[model samples]
Target: MNRRNFIQLLGVGAGATILSSTLIGCGGEPHVELFGWSGPAATLKDIRLKVLSYAILAPNPHNKQPWIVKLVGPSSFALYVDPNRLLPATDPYYRQVHIGQGTFLEIASIAASALGYKANIHYFPEGQYGNKALANKPVALLELTEAPNVKPDPLFDHLLNRHSNKRSYDRTSLSPNEEQLLQTFHQKTSDAELVFKSSAQDQTQLTGFLTEAMAIETGNKARDEETIAMFRVNQAEVEKYRDGFGVAQAGMSGVKKIVAETFFLSREKLEKNPAGFGEQAVDITHAAAESTATFAWLTTKSNQRIDQIKIGRDYCRINLQTTAMGLAQHPMSQILQEYDDMLPLQKSFKEGYGIVPNDTVQMLFRLGRAKPTTHSPRRTLDSIISV
Candidate 1:
């Protein structure tokens, strides 16, 4: 059967609840296809490919998987931006994209070292694409060399365990010891400072701002439509794309899934009640923010490309540390994005957080204890590699 006919038949033949339960229980073929257990072990024999396999799994904004790779030689590869993956509505200036690339480079370097190689990375070899949309310019050039003396990064072990936990976090504050461990990154690094807001007053204020920001985003017809376009309502779309924002990744289950599939996931329903949907979005964001044990923001001295990349590296380390400490971290950065609608919120956020005019808030997130969450699906290395 043709693709359209198959989808139509599924929609018409099975009732919504029955289909949702079946898909959730059986855990359809798309899940299996998207979640390839092993990485590049059976197909590609090259060590470079093996390293790239782990790199492809790095956390990125919206799970866009925006990095493209080209093998330069036996020991080197060039990283490029996949222009099509750009989220213009959300990330107008591509700051998040650069940060995601930085995360990829950091992971690739760590993987290379773990595999008995030292990775040398040269950023923007073809000249920097500063504060603009990603073009055909190369982001970085990675050269890997065998190093018997180099030790694998301690953070390497947590790569698979680290994920953006979207579940509501426990409200209890962190112990002095846990706080000390998380603060060490700030103490040791000159590139960025980590600011933690755990007081009830601060959390309440931040939550209010976050919910307002989220409401603004949802109320924007263009932004909402863009986000809705990426939502994978069924097992078929989720498995096929293996990317974007999927309902499964949102931690929806059973009755919630059925309701979402029947109402919220339907474009027609959303169009009919965009205002209600926006209100629902606000409520969800408020609940998530209110449950935070702490709200952490990483601030840099400048908003340059190099600083943004450094923020990515620091953010990755922070994520790994969160995983190691048995905690959850979720990025809640809508207020910091660089779109026109976000300008006022950005100014207010900086003032509220005591961030100076010259300084930039590179990342903001809520962190605390939470139930274990599932990892998002990733594309295979073969699909991402250019040559």
Candidate 2:
């Protein structure tokens, strides 16, 4: 269906659903709230749009921007996936999209907490309905809760600052105490398993395997194509249009530039031997693996969608904790994407820890002490939520 029809079906008043709810300050306020009025006096009708504004900023897989919020009442909201945003080729079963929704619920909950409220999330509250529902997937629902303590996460203060740093991380190991702190962050969350390896030799082996994985990733025609598609080649493009799985640095802009320039400067030649481009891609990936201090795998007990979202939220929280502890985290999901040869990868991963096969790896990251990097751009709250 068209965007307009879809909006209408969601009861968003057709074309008017994209409306922005900006909160105006009366006396002296530096920043204007998106939902017009603020303060406790405002009822749910007065603030539903405001609540959704924060939810829109939640991150999604591949920047597919797959979520659309339907404000059901003053204190209730529904989270739906925009099927048009699905990555059928890469995520054939829409598992990633569901995980994205989990991230959405987390964001909504956090945002609500910031506003002195809590969200009561009910996944698939109703039976399947239209394309909004994934194949046999239940409708996800969330209700707002009034709580005494709605204090935002201290880490939430760094939401804008938090980003996935893909650059070469500094070679530094976490101290025993620091390692314990990271472990604590995972221990609180029951859904995920944090696998930490400290041995320099073990890290080196994992790094080498990751390098090989990168080589294989670039060599595969389909995988390379997906990577190329997500590369936002330049600053101007990124600033103007914000949404892509990855951003390419100006000078070392990887296959992204090769692809973009192909359309602009060398379209014909690129259409020939795309495999030749894989060389630099491989090196870049390997460099990413080589320049890190430690390697960790965030695995889930089961491969359920809820578990994936839990993994995302847990990882995001841990990343902030890492930042606060004067460390850096760069996700190395490339190796885990090697679904075919994951046996050896799993074997190697299990060599250090007695992890089981039932546990699915959600994200792989390298952590160390590194200089803080620039923040990546995000979609405006205006473009995100609906009331």
Q: Compared with the true structure, what per-residue lDDT tens digits does model 1 show for residues 1-387?
A: 332332222222221111212222111111212254355465666778878887886778888888889999788899887888877888888888888888888888877877788999998899886576456878889999989999988777777667787766668877767888889755675558888888989888999999989988887877776666665666566678877655444455455555556554665666676675666667767877887878888898878777777788788878877887888888987888888888898899888777897788888998888754546778777778886
Model 1, stretches more than 4 Å misplaced? 1-37, 40-43, 186-190, 254-259, 262-264, 267-276
Find the 10 residues in a row with the least total lDDT in model 1.
20-29
Cα miss at 246, model 1 (Å)? 2.7
Measured by TM-score, the strongest candidate is: 1
Name the TM-score of candidate 1: 0.86
What is the number of backbone collisions in each predicted candidate, taken in the order shown?
Answer: 0, 11
- Runs of candidate 2 exceeding 4 Å displacement: 1-48, 127-133, 136-139, 245-273, 338-354, 380-387
The 0-to-1 C-alpha lDDT of every candidate, in the order given, reads 0.73, 0.57
- Best candidate, lDDT: 1
Worst 10 residues of 2 by lDDT: 9-18
TM-score, one value per model: 0.86, 0.74
Candidate 2 per-residue lDDT, tens place, 9-28, comes to: 22211111122333223111
